[model samples]
Target: MTATVLTIAGSDSGGGAGIQADLKTVSALGAYGASVITAITAQNTRAVTAVHPVPPEVIAAQVAAVLDDIEVHAIKIGMLGGPALVDCVAEAIAGFAGAVVLDPVMVAKSGDVLLPDDAVDALARRLVPRATLLTPNLPEAARLLRDEAAGDGAAMQDQGHRLRALGAGAVLMKGGHGGGPTCTDWLVTDQGAQPFTAPRIATANTHGTGCSLSSAIAAGLAQGMALADAVGRAHLWLHGAIRAADGMRIGQGHGPVHHFHELWA
Candidate 1:
């Protein structure tokens, strides 16, 4: 039986990130993809022009419709535009007994704020705790861990602890934005911390990397892979996708990682 994966996220018109990337990643990895769009953005390779949030009722309805019929084995969540949307998603996942991948998408590569200033608190208080796995890049990690004494690995550990306290089973602190010869990501939980590092792949095709990584993890979970193994495979898959994107000329600015790299000639 094919595993079903659901993405509760915003729509990126460019198809580089957000729901589009999540869908592609899930499908490519042999999982069925379903989506509950929380918002829509007029965005492209350049920048986000505008954002239109979907109504809370509609969001709830979408989630209900998908869960009522399909047997979702895993879920990936990204870009819930506001607190209300976050709440809507949390409510949807109330009884879902599966892997939940949360990509805390706030700042875009184009430097646009995908999430509002006020929504951060709500996200931390409500959504973060419910996630099966929370994935946050450096900046978002810092913001989430603002109370810790000076944002560093130590502080990140503190933040990760707090996130796990919030209820997430595990936290993956993605260090892609951290300035280092090697990109280091930490997977932390009440159990322990395991760090994974890889030489940074130099490429501009990282537009949808976060979305892709989370979706890949979800796919692995859907396929009944262990958490550590799922994360490792996702890392390998992303490396290949990035290398594939390095050779393609998709847009004028930052392009998307080649999602079909596994099949590309």
Candidate 2:
């Protein structure tokens, strides 16, 4: 059977991030993707000008529609509009018994906030416990913990474990925001912290990176890869996508990473 992954996220008009990115990534990785739009954004590579939340009841309906007919093996969630939507999603997915990759999408690539400030608590308190994997960049991790972003490896390790305590099965602390020749992502589990590092490619076009990565991991999980292996494969794939980003020349501002880099070449 073909693996199936459902993405519950916002619709990005730019075709770069959010639902667009998630679906593209799932398809590129040879998985079937089903999506439920939780919000809609008037956004592009430059900025997000406006956002409108999808009603909680409607969001729940979408969740039910997908889960009812499709045997979804994994789920990727991003950019919940606020606390209410967070609660809606949490309650809706309560019975699902598959890998849930939650990318706590707080901000966009263009520096615009995708999720509001108040929604952080709801996400941490409600959805964190339900996630099979929590993928948070430094800023988001700090926001979730109400602490400073990790400044080094030790701090990253500490924060990863702390996030794991919040009830996620595992937490992956992403280091893209840090300055270094090599970017290292730490995956924290009950066993210990495992580091996955790749040489940081110098690229200005990293749009949709987090979304695509989380979706890719979901794709792997849907195809039956273990959590650690899924994360590692997604990390390597995203590195190539970022490396090939400039080849497309997407927009005047930050362009999107190449979701189909391998296939296009």
- The local distance difference test score of model 2 is 0.95
Q: Write the per-residue lDDT of candidate 1 for residues 143-194, one digit (tens) a residue.
A: 7666532245665666777778877899988877776567777888777887
For candidate 2, the 10 contiguous residues with the lowest summed lDDT are 109-118
Can you list the residue pairs that collide in candidate 2?
none
Q: Which stretches of model 2 miss by more than 4 angstroms?
A: none
**In TM-score terms, which candidate is top?**
2
Which residues of candidate 1, in runs, are more than 4 Å off? Answer: 147-155
Encode model 2's per-residue lDDT on 197-253: one tens digit a residue. 999999889999999999999999999999899999999999999999999999888
User: Candidate 1, overall lDDT?
Assistant: 0.86
